[model samples]
Target: MSLHPMCGVFVLLSICLISFTTPCYGGNILVFPVDGSHWINMKVLVEELHARGHNITVVRSSNSWYIAEKSPLYTSFTVQIKENLEEFFGKYLKNHLKMEREGASALTFLKLTKDFISMVSEGHFLWCEAISEIFDDPNRVKSLIDAQYDLVLTDPAVSAGVVLAKYLKLPLVLNVRWIPSGEGHFAVAPSPLSYIPVPGSGLTDKMDFMQRIKNLFFHSIIVLQQKFVVGPHYNALCDKYIEGGCDVFSLLQEADIWLFRSDFVFDFPRPTMPNIVYIGGFQCKPAQPLPADLEQFVQSAGEHGVIIMTLGTLVNALPAEVAEEIASVFAKMPQKVIWRHKGERPSTLGNNTLIVDWMPQKDLLGHPQTKVFVAHGGTNGVQEAIYHGVPVLGIPLFFDQYDNLLRLQERGAGKIILLADVNSQTFEQALKEVLHQESYRQNIERLSRLHRDQPIAPMDRAVFWVEYVMRHKGAPHLCTEAYKMPWYSYYCVDVMVFLLSAAAVLLLSTLAIFRFLCCSRKRKTKDKQH
Candidate 1:
């Protein structure tokens, strides 16, 4: 039977609609991504770019843990670097946890900071060397130059991408949350200590005097780290490779766009730059069918519901005692627990809990049976919890975990139990509160609705901005000239001083004139009297 004329018209219209809605792809993109968990999100972007028909080339360190040497998503150009920092990071996490257990004494605090600074310095040094090697290799350098990539996309946590982008003179886009110096906004936006809290400060946007003092001190430490610790390594590379030596902070600020991994829903409101695009929870989606066995476990909870716990991949597991305490609490709970734990099994393991190396985190959170998330408070985890509207009982470990959880707690969507205070009593109480409280669920669900109520999906927004940069060649217009200005000039301190000086000089001249005129008048009166 022949198709009706109207049916043919509808099919043709559908094709035109589909074509117009999607972007024409095949832009050449060069990705220099930081490995480990950073790679997870970067890979998400790579996949989307690939689907959009873009050609991508990723630079990977030979010692990469999570990033593979071979991938269908993108081809990797591996650089050999001695010493795997993952092992160093693992050891640091263990010792750091041990120190926390010992107590937060001055000595322990100093030791922890010293180790942290050393690890940070070492990681930058290795990558700086790797980028240096790439620069020295005539053939590879030529190949990169010849490729004529439209832009350089990187995670600014490591300074290599920022530097490499400068060296290549390509438009740069940062998949940024943390820069080498500090948080992304501190470099690219006008962040005031009065309101915007520095990371690691443990202060929220609404801070009192003492909290502001703490925030200032934290800001100072970040500046010191930039100046004394990570700066020299990249500065040396910059001096050698690029015409004018550039600091990591400056290079980071110069990026055409920042695909910020946070949204205002998750982050406290503060100053932001136009170039920064908030793509938080972009990796999230509707839950797929759970693996058969995992589905069975989740279903077994029945009306009680399931509690999902995962503390990220950085640490193998919490110290045995902490784990035992947590496990015992899970055992007592009516909710079935699915925990991603990878050490000696906790002695208090209960039939209600399932221990696994990994569980589908996003899937679990999206599941209706999942009640509360017990997490380490990583950005990905916290944002995912908010995305799924799952209330969180956070046991923040290190880095920005505390601050991430603090946002949730501030919003009443989550509760935090510090590692130093993670005994069975605290863990059990916190878990019970989150699991039973209707308010927590309501707040988070509201947040989820707000997150979904965007004009466009975050993933599409990210890809659009990436292609935006590619189309525009560079987005210097969107970038602030503030980075190029020194602090005194940027804050208009010179202008302030100039205005104050002019006023002071005018006042002095007027006073002098009055005194002289009064003296002359007095002399003339004396002459007349004589």
Candidate 2:
């Protein structure tokens, strides 16, 4: 008996669904995320992998161990550190703000490099020690080795993760929180300093000769410092724990995959390798409804709209004088202000402003009545603003914050005011321009559309690539030939030297022959005269 047409269609649909939904065997994965914001940023990807039926293990701080415990699919290993990392960060922030108050002139490239190296070194040493203590227990080492993890995912910001990967003898994957900086250059394809601005240089791709020279100088200094100073320090720490010596620079260069938290839309154009993936807005989700109190406050502004100001968690508060100046500006503006302040309430704060300890920044930015975001130019904050179509007034504090703001300004989606230069007048004027200006809104809206126009959601793409790596056993074929070449060979220095030497010899030979002919002619003339 022949089947009905609709029945045949149903049979075909059933077959397709069965084929698509068939579950493939998942691999065991181990993740080592550094404490604080790095872990927070990576949690989403980790959770997704867990949901995909992969056996996932995470090594995190004791304070944040509960996060991993909440999920039944994840195995948690907590490390206790003697010194509080938060305390160190608090001290570092105080010093950084003090430097800003002193003047931007005092924030030279070398000083910033020194400050960063000191901070990262202290943090790295602590983290490495924590991981080493874990392996000091023979039982734990034997258990981890027996787990036979198919992949090791880590944040390259902390070299301890690389050492763990080395110890486990597993394929390494990098889940980076920012755009590829100087250290990243050695790992991936070559990015010429002439066009690709160094992380904190605050220059754009369209640099003039002088600016290019300055960028090149900073780039060279940073690379040298990482190689000569930071690399050795990390290597020593790694050697103390892992069996074979772990060179972080070599480990980074040999990484199987680099999942960056930035997209080309928000970054300058530069060369990248096949293994380098851009999953910029993976952390952003659809905004949820605001809390009743926040909704009421937002609605009270009527046609004027509301402004949200935050410097992220690390920077809980601004300098006292800068806070007062910003408060004074907000008081005169028509827009209602929501300031996430962790310090004493500013004396200059007016009725138009509401000071809170925390805020749902993405939800606020998504609100139609939310006019502008005043932020510290962090990657997460800026990407959220872009996703929600909110123009920014960036007050960059340190590190990649300056570069993030520079990109925003280049795209005409934001304006930057130096923390050292912020006063009532400057703050008021910049805020007014960004809020009242139609072009800022228009530019950001265009970018927002582009950011959301991807064929596949960023989270799904991230998951697919991660699984692809696992399924293909590290996907070694995707790596670039550049990774295999030495620095000199990759840059073609040897080829250039050979060509130059050959040309020099040819020129010398021609000159010598000309001199010999001249001498012969002169001798012939002498013979005739004789």
Candidate 3:
């Protein structure tokens, strides 16, 4: 007998209930993202796992640190002092304020104070402190461990969670937003810039005296911040949250799996660990239909097409000299340009160009009229362009931007322009080459196809690994035994390596011995003859 639709739905519900209620592969999964953006994709992933009958828990910190939001407190003298002082130098300083409110005045302050900004900006410390409190609170850690979560997934920023995971003996998968490094070239501070290749490769390059000194210097900065700043703050929060005296190197060694958000497409010749996985371009998803107004903007740009100029989330707003160079380029461009400027529209905005403080980036790139993406060469943005088969004119600002742009060029997907040289002529010419060149389009399309054809979506792959650990009771197999060994033992070359070295040494010794005996005998024979 054929079942009614309602009956089928009922049966499906029954099956789902049984699946979720019944014993599943493993325990609950906990996720910690630095903020909304860092954990955005992972949040979606955990939700998917939950729908599939796996349990999930997300521990998020408040967006800010404050005791209360009431008017009485808001107007209190102490509150105002905190706000004003914090606003002057805090992460909630003008740039972040401008980001939230899109205020012109704040943007002006942001540009002027850009160089003077310190890493200790209030918001950065506040959020980190908040997350640390949650992770290090013995009660919270006990509760998480008690929940019997088999796995912990976190970004490198949340190293406190790493310590918690270790205490709980749970497996870890690092969603590395940046390159994982100890005191080395590829590693940059907060972590060691150990991974970048220079005189040597990978960890070997780390042997350079200058590089090690730099690593130690940068590492010391992290240690000092933790000791003087994070340690005191953490101690005040809870006695159990004592700084373990862990550094970036310790954290790197602890991560069971290092999932790089960058791909070999960008970070090549990277000094990688055994567990490192390149799952970059993970945000490469299919396009959605553009909004009618936005679609119209793309269409109005004509057959010559438009150039998309973006400086990414961090540096979209720049100082006046940089801003003027961008404005000058817009004035000279023949095709329409959609520039994502966070500040006031410059006076040099050309008639053909439309300068909006923001654009739906993915939608812009997917459109037919987008020819070249002028970008800061952020890994995420670069991946987005490739995902849409859009070539780029990369003007790298700092950090890994240069490396990312260099790889894009190597892949034949775009051109790189240093920020110093981002004048009208260079910008115009680079735009022309990327837009007009057949090779760039072909290369980007090829990259897009490769990006699309990955064995699994990076998010899905990430989820599977997370859940796999949960199901297999920490998947101890997937984790490294490095922590089980001392640093000297871990670095000591194995038997095969030692044997190869020993054999070479013995061969050289024998040759020397033979030569010495021959020389001695020759000297004696010469003396007797004389």
**Who wins the lDDT comparison?**
1
| lDDT (Cα, tens digit) per residue for candidate 1, span 1-530 | 99999999999999999988865857999999988888889999999999999999999988789889898988888998888888788888988998877687798789888988999999999989988888999999999999989999999899798889999899999888998887989888988999999999888899999998899999999999999999999889989999967667778878999999999999999888889999998988888999999999999999999999998978778899999998999999888999999999999999999999988999999999999999999999898899899999998888899999999999999999888888999888888898888999999999899888999999999999999999989899998888888889998999999999999999999999999999999999999999
TM-score, one value per model: 0.96, 0.89, 0.68
lDDT of 1 at 97: 91
Q: Model 3 misses residue 95 by how many Å?
A: 12
* Segments in model 2 whose C-alpha atoms lie over 4 Å from true places: 1-13, 22-25, 63-73, 102-116, 177-186, 237-246, 504-530
lDDT tens per residue, model 3, 26-45: 45666554443455445445
Best by TM-score: 1
Residue ranges of candidate 3 with Cα displaced over 4 Å:
1-27, 36-56, 64-148, 179-248, 269-274, 482-530
Ranking by lDDT: 1, 2, 3
lDDT for 13 (candidate 3): 100
Per-model CA lDDT versus the true structure: 0.91, 0.82, 0.61
- What TM-score does model 1 achieve against the real structure? 0.96
- Badly placed stretches (over 4 Å) of model 1 are 1-21
